[model samples]
Target: MSWSDRQSPIVAVATAPGRGAVGIVRVSGRGVAPLAQALTGRTLLPRVATYGPFLDADGQAIDHGLALYFPGPHSYTGEDVLELQGHGGPVVLQLLVARCLTAAAAPDAATGRPVLPGLRLAQPGEFTERAFLNDKIDLAQAEAIADLIDASTEAAARSATRSLGGAFSHEVNALRDGLIHLRMLVEATLDFPEEEIDFLEKANARGKLDGLQAALQGVMRQARQGALLREGLQVVLAGQPNAGKSSLLNALAGAELAIVTPIAGTTRDKVSETIQIEGVPLKVIDTAGLRADHETSDEVERIGMARSWEAIGQADAVLFLHDLSRMAEPAYAAADAEIAQRLGEALAGASTVIHVFNKADAVATEAVATHLAAPPAPAGQAVALSARTGEGLDSLRQRLLDMAGWQHQTEGLFMARQRHVQALGEAAEHLALAQAHAAQQDGALDLLAEELRLSHDALGRITGAFSADDLLGEIFSRFCIGK
Candidate 1:
């Protein structure tokens, strides 16, 4: 290992900033030895934690602690690094940091000028960036570090650890290399067409393309599931007036978030809550019940209904509470057939709906049981108990978790935003298109090659091989100042 020629001596409080038993000020750059020597007023050894007193301008003891020296290329950031451990008092650490900054600013004794390319405070994720620049870790692995830090659930943390161990990057690189091989074969076939070769007709080419597509599909499936587990589920509750929508919200949230009354249009707005089902985060939204007419202004009801449908459109899953008890009322029971006939077409387009038979405690009859069990939530749907008594809530929770694709062992996932998922999806689409084109006997091979190129570039963006400066800035800017 050799020092990164582009490295600068960066310093920061590697440990959390606050009062504790100890605080460490880390410095990394070309001149770590001299910097430590100036600060501690003693010779330092590599990989050894030596106890010493960090000094002030006048040789006064600022703090007595430990000093560790790590020679370049074998340490974090692949640069010469030094760590000064001292008492965790805020003022003491501040002074120590100031002293190190001043010392690192001085010229190297051999050069008699600034040999350290200016010891600046490390930027948020700068150390990790350096690691990536030096080939110590890839961009995906570096991002995993932040995910591990910001993980909201145990499952998320587990997945982040897997990513940090290179699970996600390994899978991506494998796919990328496979794509390269496929492209090589296709390009070779195209270049040597004079040999009367039928590349498309060749079993080798067909088998390779099929296998590549299958592998890509498998990766896409896992990526989608991993992304869902990382991001969690967003569920929206929508139904008609007095459908016990607010009650269901409260039941799911385990608290009264929205006002529930006998009033048909009591909730003329939207309310949202976050609840965990089997440790999977579910963002539940309760909207104003949809109705034909309202005493409230039509404008208000219109906006509420619009928002309800908006939620339904964006939701990963929906819980349509039908209020079976109310539906079974004598006035309602007579028109059930007619209403079902009309509602059939509307429900068909819903992405994923869990036909929750709310208020089950009130309608615990044989007919209701048979009707509820008859459909099985239509393959990813569920029917459960009272939003009031919390009955069958466990089953509902499990169903929601299952829909989110949350697994008991949530390993090998990294926290990714909607943007990353979109890019990967687009790449997968292009790859699919390329496969489709390649399967043809006498088709536009150039178009297929172009799609493969586009797909490769899309994957390149994940590791930042094809990212812009603004994107990097935007990503690191979101981190805490001392990260």
Candidate 2:
């Protein structure tokens, strides 16, 4: 939206659309006190909730509720804000919103002019976007607001709350401060060309750079974990028909989510479920059993197989299941080998693969042990588990966590998006170049200063100290209407 558009008084139903005990209609802008008085038919005490009726233009009660007024420079968006809490029936909320617009546009009895001019409906995320623009919150904190609302797990919600509370912004600002200090030192050395090396050495420029890099690494590690929490791992289960893929999924989820049967093509589609391990969400998918084209003459089964490969290509990891009981069958072994070869080719090292030998309870212990010792595919970790009996599931879960790089360290860790991770990575790259320049015998002060400046900017983007308008729009646009 344009700058002036954002400046217009905006109103929206702040509560979600549904029938509930209460709903809220929020209005924010300059000179909103007059509008509040017009709506409530009395002056509202600033920052105090007054129980009353929300009146219509005809001077009649539309709804009995609570009204709160917050004056400019002291409210959420740094603008005057008026909130009306009423019954949460969808129709009632709509009427209240319409009433707000009507009240804002009506002529004032005192001046015969609009009570609040330029009143309009708020766009999606406009409320929170205004908070960011007004300095009430930084970019990361603003993002965290949406993250907290959409969090899928308790851990994710807590981390998002921390970020919204400025935990992430605090760290980014600290790094920026360090970078600024180092830049000042390097730039000063650039001015004194003759004594550049001596000045840098005396100021301990290399030592400062080393300290900043170490701190950056620490933040990067935590940020990666936070990102993992936000975007959970996608795990797809693959194997020949009826190789216990469905059973394994059901066991891991602790519920019957997919159909398990002895039929080779019982599952002709993808079945997905999100299971949390140590607060980390893993979306496990059971796909149609992988098999040779000639083995499945049915068109539906062939289509399912095609989709299975497509999912594998997009998965973060693949579980290639092997039937332990069928290992003695020559045809079964050859088919398993063919499927393994196709998996390696399809994944091409893009996704991690875990060798899972299933149905151990149905086979001899020695056979299971021998197969585990020498997995058909020696590419990744192998686990011999009986899905029907729930054996060895814990080991598989731990291996998945290890592959995801989760360290089980949650204290002080804030929620982060993929973009935050990328920005930190870029900053680290710039710092590495700066370090290389500082290590030279006759270090180039100007080059070092430029690298530090670039790194500083990269970090600034995280907290919005340096950000593009388009970036801000993109980030806020994802939020639901009414924030």
Candidate 3:
């Protein structure tokens, strides 16, 4: 929160630790020109790569590599920066870092100012944080830097890149700009109390609010898609033993990830696979089957069932699979009904539970028809598919994507975290409230102004035009060290 904390010169290992093709010791702050001179034994030209041996405190060669210097105001972090690109060996990088810190603490011969003292090792995401502080990039772009680095799928990576390039921020700022203009119009009219109504009517405030709402709805829809990319969806595959849970898991993953067997209770533990469904990451957890009190006797099976319930509790979606082949048996139907009851109770209506009737290929035609006519799920939509034959899987995939609020789009998606989505939702709420105030019978200009301000603030938080110190700390703290 202090000026010294954000502006202090910092150093870090910019490359991954371990023997890579090369490593870089990055330094950023004021007086980096002198710091570079001290380390390389030669003045580094701005934005130029000069080959040299990185020097120690005693002017000895530490390692031969390239030294690049970028002067302040036009570089990353908006500060004078220096990079010592050396061999990927760990010791050499550490030695270079030590020498920079030592130089920073030592006073210069010509000038009384120390080379660049207080240039300590950077905390996690300090460089990107500094960039944000210096106006080189906004907070959303700063977050995108981390998101891009930690992307789990190609789609996620691309969206992160788009966000980093300001696609998402531009849209939000445009919405904010519109809101600001409207606020200005409304508040300006407040000064002329007698003509306020006439001004609002001429300005068409309601129409402008409606336009803003339309824009916000579009942005929120895109943000929801982007959120799906970021958080993905966790789906748990659960049913009775040998109800084709493992078969469905294998079919979805397109691999033999789970062992299939004719004997009941073969899968006594959970098997998981993360598959991309139309570019949306879907984590499918195949859990051990639930059993009635009299059916499960083995201790291991009990433990597995406990774990199955635990997984179900945490899932975003629950695929309650049923074996259609056994639908004619009353005991089987009773057991499934009991499990469904428990699922309804355990789920608490948070997770999207889909009652999936599996083994359609192996079932009799009449039985499949009857079961389809009267599915047993009390709280979820029903899906019928054959795991072994891979029938109706496309529809299942589409259903899962739909449950997660995923909309298939080749473009226009930028990665967004849950906070971004929440902020947008709040902004939308305020916008709607502003419209409500404006449409009041007597009109409430002051209240309308207040609502518009709230909407603006909410949108501002997305780009960090309005942010709390603790929020910045939390956002940057999640980044990996040296980012």
Candidate 4:
């Protein structure tokens, strides 16, 4: 929806859609206090939780709950807000929401004030969108609210919290302010053509642009790390049948999530688990055995093998497991070579391939040394581990983290989306063009000014100062209702 369109009061069940000990039905926008009183039959003091029975159309009690009223200009969404904390039954919570809509529609007999006609069910992320439009929070901070709720790891949660508290936006705003200062100087020099060159040179505009470029690079590095935490690596376990793929899956998950057996082609399907390394989530997918198409004529095994190849194709990283015990067998070695060639072709330059040698306990140290010393894979990593004994698992875990490019502690990180990273890159590109224009002995003043304006516009997009209507809609549409 357009930002200029007037908004009406909105209501929804803010809690998860299930039974719990307690649930919340929230209302926000104009006449929230009056609506609260209409349902409660008592004046609700601002910012206080008043306990009472919520009445229906016939003054019959619908439910007992706590009614909290937050008056306008100080509440969430920068409007009057009310929350009804009630029992956690799905029907009970929905009934409370129905009561809110009904009350918002009813007119007072004495003052002839009709309930807000616009009061209705809230759309997904509408509340937060209202907050952004009302100046209660900026666009980045609004996105953080959803990010904080959807965080899959402790590090992600902490980083999202930092962004919600304005860490990311603060950095962007500071850079924007510095850029604005430089733009003012450049544009001001254009008005007087005589001293323009000497004026820009004397002002050291190039030096200031260099400093700004350095600062942008620093923020970009942190943002890249934060993006990794939000969108973690998808690592798939691929190898021949009975190659200890399931055992490695269990070891990484710290549980027997997949069945382990000695039977060839035991795992005729894919089993997945999510594990974390240094608070970065890794979705580990253990696929069935990879073999020649005709060798396993069993219909199920053939399908499983095809799926394994499919998973390898889309993976962010592939952990190609090898059984060390079979490294010396001539037939086994030939099959291994065939699989490696297929992997090289399928993955190409798209994914990182890590060579993991499993069943270390079954082979001697000298044998492992001779095996690994042969040749390295094309890319990614190579490590040896005993999934049964849990040896070298630490090395594997750290290797996955390195592949994901995760760094820094929670306190030093802030959550960022891919869009934010792309925006930063666009701004950097514009700034570089501006720098080139400024460096010329007799540069066109108009071109230099235009480049600076473009850079400023790019930076402002992050904070909603120069955002488009469709972009805002796309962003808020991802959030769940009543956010």
* Winning candidate number (TM-score): 2
Cα lDDT tens digits, model 4, 1-483, are 643343777898999998999899989887676787788898989888899898998899988989898988898889888888989999999998888887777887667777656788988888898899899999889988998999999999999999999999999998999899988887878877776357567878889889989999888988888888888888999988888999999999999999998989889888999888888889999999999776777998888898999999999999988899998888777888889899999998799888889999999999877766665454336888999999999989888877777664667788998988998999899889988988888866688788878888888898899998889889989999878
- lDDT of candidate 2 at residue 184, scale 0 to 100: 78
Model with the higher TM-score, candidate 2 or 3? 2
1 or 4, which is superior by lDDT?
4
TM-score of each: 0.78, 0.97, 0.95, 0.96
lDDT of each: 0.73, 0.91, 0.88, 0.86
Stretches > 4 Å off in candidate 2: 192-197
TM-score of 1: 0.78
At residue 376, what lDDT does model 4 achieve? 45
Q: Mark the regions of model 4 whose C-alpha exceeds 4 Å error after superposition.
A: 2-6, 111-113, 195-197, 376-380
Task: Indicate which candidate wins on lDDT.
Answer: 2
lDDT of 3 by residue, 1-483 (tens): 587878789999999878988999999998788888888888778899999898888888999999999898888888888888999999889988888899998999888778886889999888888889889999889988998888888999999999999999999999999998998888888887775357558999999999999999999989888888978899999999889999999999999999999999998888999999878888999998889978867999999999999999999999999998887799989999999888889989889888888998987777766676685754337778999889889988988877777778838799898899899999999999989998997788899999999999999999999999999999999887777
Error of 1 at 340 (Å): 13
Ranking by lDDT: 2, 3, 4, 1
Residues 424-443, model 2: lDDT tens digits:
99999999999999888877
